[model samples]
Target: MRRRTLIRGAAAVVLVPAGLAAATSAAASPRQKSAQADDLVGVDVSNYQVGFDYARAANEGLDFVVAKAGGCQLSEGPYTSDSYAGHVDGARAAGLRVGHYFLTGDFLSPREAADYFVDNLHDYRSGDVLALDVEVLDDSTRLWNDAEVSTWFNRVRERVGAYVPWFYISTSALRSADWSRTIASGARLWAASWGANDGSYPGPPDLGGSYPDWAAHQYSSMGSVAGTSPIDLDLARPWAFDVSGPTDPPGGLPKTSAEQDGVPGPTMWKRTQNWLRIQSGYTGPIDGVPGPNTYAALQRNMAGNWGYTGPIDGNPGPMTWSAVQRLAAQHGYTGPIDGVMGPNSWRGFSRFINADAWD
Candidate 1:
């Protein structure tokens, strides 16, 4: 639904290092120099970018690609981008780290829009970056509120386990709304600000103190890549495309008061309640009681990845424990995933939830 208004001359092809980061420029200022040295070169494409040659772009030193997944269009309502799958597949095939973004519109509620976005995502893997693009609504007078935007991010995080999604917005449009809640939701900034529009890499954007630092900067929409001309170019930090697994808590997993008897007690439940409160949308008191509220939030968080497709009824059935085991497998649970919770499973789950962050 968004279109580039300006088309500049072909960008000067800048060679990137074998690694993700690029070399610094001596002619630039101090802030610009730092951005150039640490930022990775990447491009974002939608259906408008036709027949994009991903391999050629990668050969030209591009490190990543963020393709448009789906969003609500002003005319068509909620719709998925037809080219989303091809862009993701081609970018991955070309050895480029891939990401996906969903454009938000005024048609649907933020929760519904986020659910649609996650449902329409193609070939999603852990560590793949996700983003919510919010810009000015040309056709509608209503702008997205802070709580609405936060709801979108929180809903997406509920489905996808770890990692925060990037929040994309231009400097002017961001000023039009209060984003305190969205910021508190842990969504990183993908600041968009084009200065001069001369196909030159702009320095660190002036976010007007809205964010401490940006995860990615969309500096030029008219920049040229090897295989694609007049494309949206971005400079992103290494954390923007980090594919490493979730970072473990400091000093490793803490000891839980639960006995090694395979049954979770009050202490473990309390910690889990706190985790669900922070990560998922659990608003219940942390009374260490494993009630329906606790299990319901856990089910929402596991629905996307752990294969818990049932309702959030707060009832932990065999399917619920099975999904919990699937999650525990990543944290050192080697036992059979037979929907059975045993001592080993408890230990592994404790390894995951027994973090100081939760406590």
Candidate 2:
């Protein structure tokens, strides 16, 4: 998440993660909650979190990083997030997935904000997901009703191709603004709601409010990680849809997941084929459902020390799981060989599948 094209004369308010204006406010939040480190860890930082250390934060179990990319400053007009460049380079170096966001200023039209957003993230690859911060940063700035938000988002989509944008808004703002239209308009959303570490927040934003469920929830803006403090804590549900475009750290992992495809049909196989291409130079169709050609390609990859004794059938079973487990073990997994594929297992296997989404 680096800089984007600036929109002049427009006023925009950029809230630090968790609505805190600064890191000192991390303490102002409710007491830190205790949760499993294995949970998906993330943080959103702006210039307010000065001298941000991307490596240390990743070591702190950070799985992803969201950096402020666009915002407007009075006379300054629109500018990229001052910290965008450093955060983007550092986060990639630390082996973390990256996401970008734009703070919609008050004075600009929806299309202007959308175009600027697209330009700023123009360098982002298909692997990256763009987001729009839909809250009113300044009390004086007019609130963006659901229709306006949707307009900005759709325009962004028009510029960025198939890459879907995630809406980042506080739960309270969502309620106060009556944002049902905005929520229902988009296919995915990331709800911002803060509370103790007991992990009491519901799985998605208000389930009954607008969208059926949230793709991610910001549990705490002031939450602490093992290696980083004053960072936002979030839980992202595995996405069920497929996303593709240029990727951050080119040739890295794509953001799609098996859960995102639901029940692992042809779409799941398509991702596997793409991963195989990366690993062994596969040249098969990326169609979600693969036929004999896919299994044939897979057999070629299983040769030598890759380990697979089963027939060259595309159908994956115990033998296939055993081979997959063996590969996972090579990729730093020490779990029991019970043939059970856990998150850690997936992490190991995904590397062979798609390097961009190793996490």
Cα lDDT tens digits for candidate 1, 1-359? 24721111223233332322222221121123222365677889977675788888887778888998867645447777777899999999999888899877777889999899899899998878889888754343455777888899888877776754778988777756667667556576788886655446766666543443466778766666764555677777665554322222234334575435556877788777766655455667777888899998788556534666677689988889988887778778899988889888887787766645454
lDDT scores for all predictions? Answer: 0.69, 0.56
Model 2, 143-162: lDDT tens digits are: 56777787876776677676
Candidate 2 Cα misplacement greater than 4 A, ranges: 1-39, 73-76, 176-187, 196-204, 226-228, 240-359
- The residue pairs that clash in candidate 1, if any, are none
Error of 1 at 89 (Å): 0.6
Worst 10 residues of 2 by lDDT: 28-37
Runs in model 1 deviating more than 4 A are: 4-36, 137-140, 242-359
Candidate 2 TM-score to native: 0.55
> Which candidate number maximizes TM-score?
1
TM agreement with the true structure for every prediction: 0.59, 0.55
